[model samples]
Target: MKGVIRTILLIALICIFSIQFTMSMVIFTDLDNHWGKEHVNWAANTMELIDGFNDGTFRPDDIMTRIDFILALNTLLVKKNIYQDVGLHFGKGINISYTDVDRYHWAYGELAILATYISEYGNADIEIKEIFTEDTFNPNKPINRHEVLLLSRAVTTPPIEDHIISFKDVDANIPNYNLIIESVNNGILRGYSDGTLRLDKNITRAEAATVLRRVATDVNYLADKFLVYEDIKSRNIGIELPIFQQIDEHESQSQLHQRFIDAITSIQYSAFVGHIPYHERHLYDMQPIETLWGLKNQNYYNVIGNNYYLIKYDKDLVMERKKELVKEGLQHLKLNVNSSFDGLISFLSIAAELLPMEETMNAAEATFRQSDNSKTKLETGLFIMSQYMANNEMDKGLNIHRSLLEYEFADDIKAQIIRNYGYLLYSLKGADEAIRILKDLKDEMDLDFNELNPNAIEFTFNGLMKQILIQSKN
Candidate 1:
């Protein structure tokens, strides 16, 4: 049964990531001919990061409040799992003791977290010091243009070096000149048609969303030109494996479980080998346990008997089965929104979205509110971080990945988390830290093989470390 469950999970992982790509475009009524229209849509629709007001107006021209910006920022941070303490103060029955902002205000936790993050890690060189040093957050006040740009730039990496400010209204004498110059050079900050940057004016909500969108879509389009599914398949040379003795049917249940676990271990090694054929052979050879469980036509099911529906999707079937599963997953999430089934349902819905089905987005949104077990919560957090990475939100992803180390997970689970965490560290923090973490992970792999089920995460651990070392030198 566990073997079947593993197969189903692997299938889902392959389906969600390897074989799907389609994104729905968002259309907002208020964005017609707006400079920030594409950005707002990308933020709202593709990234699931923002929304329109109840009447459908985005209020592009209205001044955006300080508290409201933080709230939105915090949501994106949490969705990306960037910081562990992000929403801690906002948990149930928690009271914030700030002097100006009421505990009941919607932005309380966000304000608290932002204040804490800035006070502790904020760049001292930036000119935006008054707001942080103030006793009150003044949550309702509209933020000035300079403050918005400063805050937006803060969430991302500061420029490695300063650039000369060419905008007529800005120069070395201006406050936050370095940050402003960096933002403009990077296209995160833009000048008006007249070439004057309105530094002191209050930015609207639509404008703020557009700025966030700029950070989110900063990836190099050229890098992904060769990353299609067929490219992966074309790179594969078939794998050959030594024949294994048949499993004895007379073996006890425990013995069968042990053999299947061994097969799982082989699957992990196959991933390191980076061969699709080896991975498939391991899956096919695993003995299926006799049970009154599992899906009717498929090979795996959940512990309680829910089927994992993934039809073999060659070009012939195309999206037929995936589309059906997506529909089913959304229905499950809608039906089980606040129930105990939320985590599982949410997982399925999110998996569907890798196919780029927007219908499952609500499931991902609703997951933030649902009560989830530690395992589900951890996995969900990982998924959220992956979304951030997908959208070019690397800083956010780095935080979330780093924070996962605080949890007490089973050795196998921790190993998987470390692999992802290590990758992020390499991408964001540099190689020394990533190399240190991965090296420490080697000591933890000395678990008793007799009692533990085999996990493949450790198989690629050395390979990943080597890769990071190579990249670091370059």
Candidate 2:
């Protein structure tokens, strides 16, 4: 009878263990499904710099310091080689800039400098010791959901092609306000339905975990990894193992803080992809030109010498149709224009073809003068002349080109300009002067005409000079 009792007791213990294991597995699975899906998507799509997500949980609502945001931005920038260094600098001693934040205070000195984001207000110098007021940076305080959205938007670049997030409540005029709205609009963040941004509220540990997880999954930096934990089996082990691992890695408070730092840096680096709009030709071809017509309605005029021209479209409807044709031509030109010069020339040519000749010339002249440097300004002037010449306005084009020749620029650039000017003279009724200029250019300058575009520099000594000679004989 005693042996029989022992067997029954052993069986009962096994059953209890199995029941606990099953219950834990269920909880783990639920948490994993609930948090992991969104977290993975966010990390993969929004933040791609973070790796090893399966090994950690990100606690989002935890108070974030000024150092945290900076470090994160630095990390993202570093990955893209946008900045040369990563980390912070602090003034020595217990000399925190403000009474509330002392040098020895954790993150005080760092936060003090990072507070420049708020201090950008019309020369208002930020004081560190100042308790973080509403619409200000508070290093010691917890970061709220609204603030998180703001941070996300500030660090990322513009032209975020993502779905917009809608928040029931968020004023557009607060500090870092538009960023918060943009973040939500881009689906990088979300808020409660109560229509409150809750900017001053502290974030909870679990909430932070959820946020971090979302960041990880969206970036695709840490989706595949081994997760291990004791008692994990009891919590629906396999399904929730990843989150447990993350939390376990941050078992100590300091570790948790460091992990947060690392995670933020990763998010910034991999979130945004910047590229020129014209690089993708096939994609641009499919997009309707009407979408870009609104750009033409923004008027710009230029007054050069004795002529005034309007670059702005007078009629919105006609401007829209013209824009569509120009866009189509641009798409076609992109196929043949392999060099940057060719691309630029093609773009200008297309613009000239679509807009009025006077408008194109005025726009080009205005663009040239506004350039901060001489080289770009000279190039713009040359492009304007080139367009004018194409439009049979030789006198106007020659006058602009003459102005360009007077500018002090590099030897090669000057040579090109002289060659074009000489060609322009030949095109008019000044064959003798054109021949003299071309002969002087060939004799004085050591240049490889072959290295330049044959079509672009068609007025060069070898090309245009020969044509002029043949025409003069005829």
lDDT of 2 by residue, 1-474 (tens): 999999999999999999986653322222354534444333333444322224354433234444444444434443433222223234422333555545666666445444543233111122323324445345545556655555544333221233454444555555655555655653445566676556556554344434444332222211111111011011111221111112222244444333333332332222233322455433332222221222223211101100101112123346665565454443433332221121233345547777676755565566555544444345456566555655778777667666765566555455456555655677675666776766665555544543212223222344444445435644
TM-score (C-alpha, index-matched) for candidate 1: 0.40
Q: Write the per-residue lDDT of candidate 1 for residues 169-279, one digit (tens) a residue.
A: 776676556667766754666788886888778878777787766544321111111111110011111112211112234244445434444443454454466544743
Tell me the spans in candidate 1 whose CA falls farther than 4 Å from its real position: 1-27, 85-99, 102-106, 121-136, 193-195, 217-474
lDDT for predicted candidate 2 compared with the true structure: 0.42
lDDT (CA) per prediction: 0.52, 0.42
Model 2, residue 369: C-alpha shift (Å): 30
Clashing pairs in model 1, backbone N/Cα/C closer than 3 A: 81-400
lDDT of 1 at 341: 29
Error of 2 at 94 (Å): 16
- How does candidate 1 score on lDDT? 0.52
